[model samples]
Target: MKARTESDSVSAVAALADSSRRGVYEYILEADGPVSRDDVAGALGMVRGTAAFHLDRLAREELLTVSYRRLTGRSGPGSGRPTKLYAPAVREVSVSLPQRHYDLAAELLAAAVENSHRTGTPVEESLRRVAAEAGNSIGKDADSLEQALEKYGFKPETEEDGSIVLQNCPFHRLSQRHTATICGLNLDLLSAVTGKTGPEGCTAVLDPAPGRCCVRILPPDRD
Candidate 1:
């Protein structure tokens, strides 16, 4: 499955904001299997057309998946048209203000722990390696450092000294509890991003400050 983007999450949330659409989605979620529009309409006390409208809307927003199957156990010619059915989508939808990425942090830390157990490398070293690998992957598709940082919710702001200060940390809560570890991972990740896709002679370094990300981007002479 493709990875869900922030816009996709926002669209899903908006789609469910309608009472009828939310009710239709909830009914499908509670079903044992995919349900037809008629089933939803009957269960929710809505008209068939209204239920169908909401179901299609939910499917369009990716909050529900659609399938077509004949309800009756009959063969091709004699059977009626395959009924459209709705089911809960496998993708999870989440939206956070200021745009946190705790899921990404959790994934990195879990991979680091597994790597440490398998190779006898220190957990911190494994974490840095994995985080750098992830950053490199992300950077390869990015056109510039600032674009990459902004895309990941770092909120980069350029300074007069030709440095970038990140105004927001994507892994804020995790860093608060495990400052050194999380900050180190953040620094390594941004460093890799800078190395792989540069704004020319820029470097990522740890420069922790209150109410901001721990990593900063600095020009060659300032680094």
Candidate 2:
């Protein structure tokens, strides 16, 4: 999920990198509603085909939504084909190097804290339990532990020593400010998901390192 979201951000950024496309996007944004290719070209003094190419590109990246409408207000064959219109799509895109997921952590922490306060449960305990439940819910439909982790953008990588290292932390931003709390939440989430997969000889433990998540999943012990 995180990988895909990141990829989408990259694609969106690239699509708008062109000055012409960027101009077209801005024009549509400022318009009252959906704008057609002709409208964009006429307003921007761009060639109709050039405007169309950019509009199509934007639509492909989901930056814009495409619809068709008739300007003549006539609904018969003589009314002519409906003009293709471009409108802004509801999307949020953010790109960060090394991938950070502070928002996810903040949301979980906020919910846990609020619920804990209301129920009079200890914060740490409530956080751990809630994190576990969240992981469990994510893993419930997954075919395996790795799949579950990948789906949530953990970016797990296996070491030669039979340990799995998380290459990215979705809660990195939150972890920076509240290291202990966020790390604990990460551990619980991974542990719960791993537990659901029932992978033998594996356990999640804190093993902080630069450029990676703090928790590592170790293999079962040898005799």
Candidate 3:
């Protein structure tokens, strides 16, 4: 799903690189409802043909959805063909070079926060539990620790001293603001994945380094 989303987002972004197409896209995005080609052309000072061309391009890229509706309030035998309108297709677009899963991280944190509020559990404990559950879910599809890490875009690289370091952090931005919370959540998640793949053989430790995730998976006997 993430891979597909990245591909779609890249295509969508590229489609908007044209000034005319970008203008059409932005106009539709700002509109309260679907916008007609005429409305876009008039609003952006573009010719009708130009607007239609760009709108169709955007629709083809899945950036905008096309619909048909009567411009007049009344629709009957006298009503002509419905006017074509365009609106945003996907509410959001997410693309990252290293394929960060901030949405996944945000979901776990938000759920943990809500559970803590409802059940009187410590926020930290709830976060750990939620992170572990999320990790375990992902681990089910992976046959090995390396496979799981790679799948999630951790870019896992083994060091000379028998330790594994993640070259990229999926929750990079969140970790900067909520250091302890997010890092702890990351540690718990990796620990759960590690346990499922290789029980008692490795552990995730909070060992921050430059341009890397705060948590590092360490070989057994190190912790």
Candidate 4:
């Protein structure tokens, strides 16, 4: 499956916002396997047409996957046309108001722990290394530091001094509880991102302030 963007997630959540569509989706989810429109309509007390409409809408939004199968065992000649079945899509849809990325943090921390155990390196060192590597991957495709930061929900704001302040932290909750470790990881990640994508000699540094991310990006000429 292709990677789902934030827009895809938003669309999927919106598709489920309708009470009828959500009911149809829930019914299909509880089914033992892919379900036909008739099955959904019977189970949910909905008309077949209503069920079909919801199913097709969900499928169009990529919330549900579609397949075709003949419910009855029969030869190709006389068997009726294959029934369209709906199943939950493999993709996960998540939408946070401020746009948290705990999954990304989990992935980075899990990899760091595994690497630490394997190579006997300190967990902190492993975390920094993995975070930087992840940042490098994110930065590679970005045209500029602000673009990359914005893409990942950092909410970068440029100051008149040519510095960038992150207006929002994507890992806000995690950082609140585990300030030191998460902030260090954030710094390493953004520093590497700056190295790859920021202006010449620009750097990311930890400069914690209320209501903003701990990391700030400074232009090369800044003192």
Candidate 5:
């Protein structure tokens, strides 16, 4: 998961505000390591003051952490005072969406993928583990496989054909790098929790509206 947007953070869920804060969120998210405010501005092509302002808000909200450090002094000329760095405090953020009957499995799996890459792991390995972990909790006695999906936030309902439509995404608008990983995680979670192993190559689609993402589950069984 990536840092929450500004609107997201201020909204109900973990989200923040609009894209302005989201840009800073993304900057912290993409850095291979902790970064400075100046670097964030440079990375996002925004002014240093603007970046710092957002960074301060995120820190105030406990979204990110700011710390000052002292570095070795350079004998040359421009050896200034200690520098400051910013790092994402929380790894993931929550977004709200309407519940739909259709379950799109890919989006969830993509989340797992995003998380895996963020932590420097292969996508498949992370997904497999997530699948196994979630699947281990299910027993075959309750509602349909679709019903079981609800426990893991899948919210799936069978469509005209074998398609399972997506109704919600607990994680939305994360960084691009983390996007696919977390989507993958969601997929693995759905597959494991339900023991359906939804079709491969599932993709989560955001419709032409705000806070609307359509997830299409691939065939449960396919080559």
Candidate 6:
């Protein structure tokens, strides 16, 4: 299926607002494969009826899909019946950011710095190198910016204001969670592209819209 739209993202989040729905969606998002409603209930500690309710809603929203499979000949202790499983849908139901909130960069950096400082794992250094390399390749053309960022595994789209709005973050996918380290790296790269920092040692993602975002060049930084 095609990528979900901003509107769809909003709807998806709203649909998951219920605690049960949110748990079900998050569980599915974390799973490696599809599961059944009974399995989902057991995994999430939910009653079968409530689990079925959320499962149906998620399926209706296209956040999940269901299918029946052959049940083992031997039924469970109940000796009642056998059925297929309910699993996370075929697609990952998650939010996409056309633009990273400026705070994200700082938050990521802070986390990375703290973790590296504590563990001495060199994650911070690695992140710095990636940012430096990504920054080095950015150029005047919008296409060039997109290409350069893409090389670093960032899917960036050209914004109307000539800045690039990042659509996909490989780091988030890799980590399977949000962190300050990745945000720090993004902040560095963004700073390099937009020139320099201002009030927050960062810049705002200006006028983010369909396939686009905007940025400003810091006075002392490169244009």
On lDDT, the leading prediction is 4
What is the Cα-based lDDT of residue 84 in candidate 5?
83
Model 2 pairs in collision? 101-170, 201-220
Per model, how many backbone clashes are there?
A: 0, 2, 0, 0, 42, 10
* Candidate maximizing TM-score: 1
Per-residue lDDT value at 200 in model 6? 28
User: TM-scores for all candidates?
Assistant: 0.96, 0.83, 0.76, 0.95, 0.35, 0.36
What is the C-alpha local distance difference test score of each model? 0.90, 0.85, 0.86, 0.92, 0.58, 0.57
Candidate 4 yields a Cα-based lDDT of 0.92
Scored against the true structure, residue 62 in model 4 reaches a CA lDDT of: 85
Q: Could you tell me the lDDT of residue 69 within candidate 2?
A: 85
Q: Which segments of candidate 6 are over 4 A away from where they belong?
A: 1-4, 73-84, 90-223
lDDT tens per residue, model 5, 1-223:
4433435433523335567788778778788888888888888888999888888878777778788754555544567776787888854444444333122335436655886989877777867675556554442433555655564454566667666665555445441247555555555445554454333443323222244333455454432
Candidate 2: regions farther than 4 A off: 1-4, 117-123, 141-143, 147-155
Q: After superposition, how far is residue 83 of candidate 3 from its true place, in Å?
A: 3.4
Tens-place lDDT per residue, model 6, 33-70, is 77777778899999989888898888877878677654
Model 6 steric clash pairs? 35-86, 35-87, 36-85, 36-86, 37-86, 107-180, 108-180, 108-181, 109-180, 109-184
Which 10 consecutive residues of model 3 have the lowest summed lDDT? 1-10
**Over 4 Å off in model 4, which ranges?**
none
Q: Ten residues in a row with the worst lDDT in model 1? A: 1-10
Q: What digit string (tens of lDDT, one per residue) describes model 1 on residues 1-223?
A: 5756788889889999998888788878889999998999899999999988998988888888888898897868989999998889887888998899999999999999999999999998999999999999989978988788888999999899888999999999989999999999998899999998876678898889999999889987775
lDDT for 151 in candidate 2 is: 60
Better of 2 and 4 by TM-score: 4
- Using TM-score as the measure, name the better of candidate 2 and candidate 3: 2
